[model samples]
Target: MINLAARDILHGWGKFLFTGIGLGLLIGTTLTMAGVFRGMVDDAQVLIDNSGADLWVVQQGTLGPYAEPSSIRDDVWRGIAGLPGVAETGNAAYLTIQMAHAGRESRVMIVGMDVDRPGRPGAPGYLTAGRPILHGHYEAIADERTGLQLGERVRLRRHEYTVVGLTRRMVSSSGDPMIFVSLKDAQEIQFLKDNDALVNERARTAANPAFNRPGVPGLLEAAQASSGQSRNVNAVLVRLEPGANPDAVAGEIQRWKRLTAYTREQMEDILVAKLIATSAKQIGMFLIILAVVTAAIIAFIIYTMTMAKLREIAVLKLIGAQNRTIAMMILQQALSLGLLGFLVGRASAGLWGPAFPKYVLLLPGDAIGGFMVVMVISALASVVAIRAALAIDPAEAIGG
Candidate 1:
């Protein structure tokens, strides 16, 4: 009537507990890997949702600002604005640039938006502090992750702007903080050149026979002026009327405007499936390898633990203990070990997730899935130890 499993575990508590801890750490890494993948997908979805745009109009035959380099004339929005089912359209320019703040430079996605309309497409979904960009000149808004406070001036390219507002969770697809500036300033920073380069370019153009022809009175001057200006934006964000079909509006723009247009769903596919697919696969492979390693360690530990109790197992078999009872003892012990490991892993992942630079969204469902997987693997691993224990001859107990 003795509880053989409990007695054995208690007798070697050190080995059992330490072995469980080692396995638990591996399980924790596996869980964290899955969480990292989920976080990336969630961040991509949030980016699309916060844009408040049903359709994204980009350059012809190319992905938008998130996936590739897309350049559309700044005035392209006017054409899409006049389309059917379009409730409103906003001109948005996105350029990734390094800006200096507090004597350190951090990579940021500079978003150019219209300050006149506070609730337009491409504006921050919500603010944590200060106000939205109310002026179009030298004021700026930044994500809280950038560590920039209100009234602080940051230098970008050739101009300096003061941070007048702060928002939360506003990040680029790469997890870089987003800094918002006026369309004019962003354009300048996007295509600005040094004074020396500008003067040299002017001299080169004026020396051209075609531009300096006598019949063309203002040809050289006009060419130089045009070359120094940037009149293009990355993409246009469009918000359709309520219940308007985004697919139809996108089709219309692609056909008439000869440009590529993507609905929210399409853009999400590009970001999640195309942009981050390889990284996701890499994480998945790591999870698989970790699971294998965890299972191997558990099997070896359990087999070794069971082997140490050979005398007890032999005596139990000789004293009328059924084979099922011995097998169940091993199975129960394996499952218990798995449960302990899972708890440790879940707690560890939660503790370290926030400290990660990128967003680490650990969902409850994923944690539950991880627990199930560990238990199954542990059960499979116990098979080897169970078989080995069951093979021990009952006669061994009597030293025969």
Candidate 2:
């Protein structure tokens, strides 16, 4: 017996091909959404990996450095360094702000790290160009995604920083490109008040009798000077000794230091689960909507195709064609359309994924899963058309 599905598709190849292409574009968008979600998870993992720390020490009772506002004295790392199983510790400050370039401003995550220790925790893992921050204040190591070239000057708050190095794929949990600066500069930028605010603050301090008692000479000047500096950091990054248990070290730090300590796994969970949770849910909703739309479109196409071939279906029935055979024909056509659409969508996603502003990681596993879902949706969508065809009266072949 002739293959009815193949014959019908070949007979109306143009319509079938175009319909598949349209459906494929929709599928492509769904696939791209999955990739975007995957990219976010990857970006979060990259952040944890690049920090080079086994644990993060933040302010007590708070998720710090990324998820929430956490401020502790910059000197906190000194005590954390002496903890057992701690091999190295670094003071890190994170401030997401707009940095001015030549004519426009770009939002970037300004990472303050211990510049004195090159290749330490919180420093850029690798440089694609130039060297790390050598000078104490103005030098920076920028992520390539920030559009900052090596030696380019970018202003951060009150100071101009020269991008001394460029690193690739160095981004924060929110996918913001990171610009690494000295810990002192980061602290100042993160916490220091503006010049006007500072002046007003000093005047308030001088006017307050409690702080500036006339009997205590030099007290007012000392208070004003101390108010101008920022000595706070967001978190302390701790590297553990080889083979040390991260949980054990984190527990010790939390118990002894009176601070919150997050192990690598805990930090990853916070970043993926809490930090980007809303975004992930939004993407998931989009995926669900897209799946519903795709199914509806497939069902409509199949139903229309079946209705148009009603007379043919009637004639087949009049010629003693079995209902199961007709059902198989429709099922095969739906599967073929779905297969075509999936191939087009997979290719489309790969082509345009890199052009997105943020990373889009298209994993092979996701593609496989998407393809399976599409085929299943296609089969289910054919039910309406199959039912319609099975209801046809054989007498209609001769009457019409």
Candidate 3:
């Protein structure tokens, strides 16, 4: 028996090739969406890994430093350092802002860390180009993604910080590049407002009845003075001793300090599951929509191709061809298109994944799963064509 599907495809090779190319582009977009979601999860993991801390201490009843707004006394780390099984502790604050350097602007996460200690939490894990922050007040270690160079000054929140070091792949949970600065400066930049906002707040405080009363002497002046300084840290990072129990130390801090303590696992859950919930949902929806659209396109192509071969199909039936043979012919063509499309889509995703502004991690498993789904979709889409072909009357070939 001759291969009917192969013969038909060769007769219309151009049409089949062009149709598969269109489907391939659609499949490529779907693959890219999966890569984007994978990248987000990896970004969260990277954030946890780079901190180099076993436990995160934050404000009571709140998620901190990434998922939610948390405030704790800047000096709380001193007490935490004395806890049993605690090897090292560092205070950190985070603030995201759009910063300009040499007429170019990029959004970045400004990390305030303890520059007094080497290998401190929140410090960059590796330096790609320059050294770490040396001076306390205005020195910075910027991620290479931020487009900042060594010896460049980036004016941020009333202070100009000189970039002295460069790090690679140091990004926040939101995929913004991080710029490391001294704890004091980060506190001020994170908590302090602009000059005008400060003036307004001070004026409001001075006009309050409790502060501006005639019986109160210098109360308003003192309140105004206190408002200008930043003494709050968002979170404290703790490193454990070689044989220490993180849960026990965290419990001690919670019981005595009245602050929240989260182990590394808990922090990862917050960042990946809670913080990125909405974004994940959005990507899921896009994937679903793309799947539906791709299925529709495939169905249309297969149905049209089968309908166009009605005369040939009628002649085959009149010559005593079995229904299985005609059905197999259509199914084979559909699978061929799917296979070609998948190869093109996989190649496209690999070539363009790195060009994305944020990370796009295309894992091997995802690619394999995607190919399986595409093939299944192709088989299912061929159902309409198969059924239509089987319905052709053998008499039609002789009647004309």
Candidate 2, superposed: residue stretches over 4 Å from native: none
Show model 1 residue runs off by greater than 4 Å. 100-105
Best candidate (score: lDDT):
2
What lDDT score is found at residue 89 in candidate 3? Answer: 91
Error of 1 at 48 (Å): 0.3
At residue 219, candidate 1 shows an lDDT of 88
Assess the local accuracy of residue 89 in candidate 2 as a C-alpha lDDT between 0 and 100: 93
Top candidate (TM-score): 2
Decide which is better by TM-score, 1 or 2. 2
Q: What is candidate 1's TM-score against the reference?
A: 0.95
- Tens-place lDDT per residue, model 1, 1-400, is 6766777778778877887787778888888899889888987887888788999999998998799999989899889999999988888889888877777778888999877787889888888888888787888999988889988888888888899999988888877889988888888888878899999999999999989998879989999999998889888999999989999999999999999999988999999999999999999999989989999988987888789889989998999899989998898889889998898888888888888888888889998888899899889999999999899999999993
User: Which pairs of residues have clashing backbones in candidate 3?
Assistant: none
lDDT, model 3: 0.91
